[model samples]
Target: MLFRSLKPLLAGEQHLQLIWLALGSVPVVEFAAHANPDALVLDLQHGLWERTTLEAAIGAVGMHVPVIARCAENSHGAISQALDAGAASVLVPLVETAEDARRAISAGRYPPTGKRSAGGVRPLRAGLEAMRAADRDVAIGLMIETVEGVENVEAIAATAGVDYLFIGTGDLALSRGTSDSEVIGRDCERIVRAAAANGLPCGIFTANARAVRQAFESGCRMAVSANDIDLVKEGFLAARKATFEC
Candidate 1:
């Protein structure tokens, strides 16, 4: 709870940062955390583990930096458990409407503000103050990936307590059935504008340096670098190419 959430980073001058999405392996995740990325997004949705594994991995990250768990879905229990597991924040994916965004936010916050129950691991270990701090220090991130999301993005961005909107444009492209630059760029620009209108930062899951540059140049704030799989593949290809070509 003492650790600052991605909210501050998103609001700071250094809006550019890396987001790690990986399986719920403690050592592997900890290694990513060790690199001190701007934030690490635990891919629980696709990771090969139950929510319990996330709790263990979060402890392993040990406040290295902001650890955000991308919950499997929009379930209230899942969101509550994610934050309770020590994640500085939880990203609810496929959030398409303002109501969906509101539901996710309500589940993440405490009573009066939300229906999230208290007495997570933090509270038991660090006392009542820690549980209280989760609401304050912890942030909420939502992903707008589908067509509906893009359509109502303006209202979603305006939702209070919604920290930032991370664009899941990979799926967006797939949905549109065309990786056309013009199409993607147009959508990205619209999303950025929506976030800007409501004083929220916009983030993109970047595929490379060029994508990162484009996101920043187009008025976006956060640029989540490529995932580990691509990094490993690119590393291997470069190393192999150097040896063979040289």
Candidate 2:
């Protein structure tokens, strides 16, 4: 609940798309939180991070902006743990059907709305009100990553409690067996349309700022602007060239 409210996103304005910095370490988390992009993405799905890292990152961020955890899978444990550790949002990956979307939603919710038990570390520290407010505060992002996912995009988007529909272009390409630009464009369009029809925002994963901007033009309202490793690599490469080149 410490992360900023989801008012703009919930209000459905074509406002500035949130540029989130992805990170998995304490120092990087603190730096990114200080730099203060739209939000922070903890890459549990693909990043080599454990539970302790996520907890430390959450503490470092301390609600400057939303800290969203992109979980490893679409499961209750994965979804709920991130929420319980005080992630304002959770991104569930590899979702292929409406049921997969539904399961993710149910897992993150409370008893009446979901099966998630109410014992998050942050919530406990904040006392009763935070726990009660959690239902309204937690944002749920469901990823559409496979051919089957694309085929059922509309149904999945229409599922309840889905705050956003995110496209994992890399995984989709792998699943579809081709990385053709045209095919990815078509897929992005379809997923964006699905989210629009369901009154939700759309997001995507991009490797660089050029692609991130292009995705916004293609109707994605948000993108992964940078990750810790990428930033370090880019900085080192630039410095190396500047220092060594004649």
Residue 199 shift from truth in candidate 2, angstroms: 0.7
TM-score of each: 0.90, 0.93
The parts of candidate 1 lying over 4 Å away from their true place are: 235-246
Worst 10 residues of 2 by lDDT: 14-23
Q: Which residues of candidate 2, in runs, are more than 4 Å off?
A: 10-23
lDDT of 2 by residue, 47-79 (tens): 867788788888777567677788988888888
Q: In model 2, how large is the Cα lDDT of residue 92?
A: 93
Query: Which lDDT tens digits does candidate 1 get at residues 1-246?
Result: 545567778778666666566645667777777677788878878766566677777777746778888888998888988887888888899999999999999999987888888857654687766677657777898998887899999999999989888888888898778889899878888888998898887888888888788788888788876577676678899999999998
lDDT at 64, model 1: 72
Candidate 1, position 182, lDDT = 92
lDDT of 2 at 188: 84
**Cα error, candidate 1, residue 125 (Å):** 2.1
Give one clash count per candidate, in the order shown. 0, 0
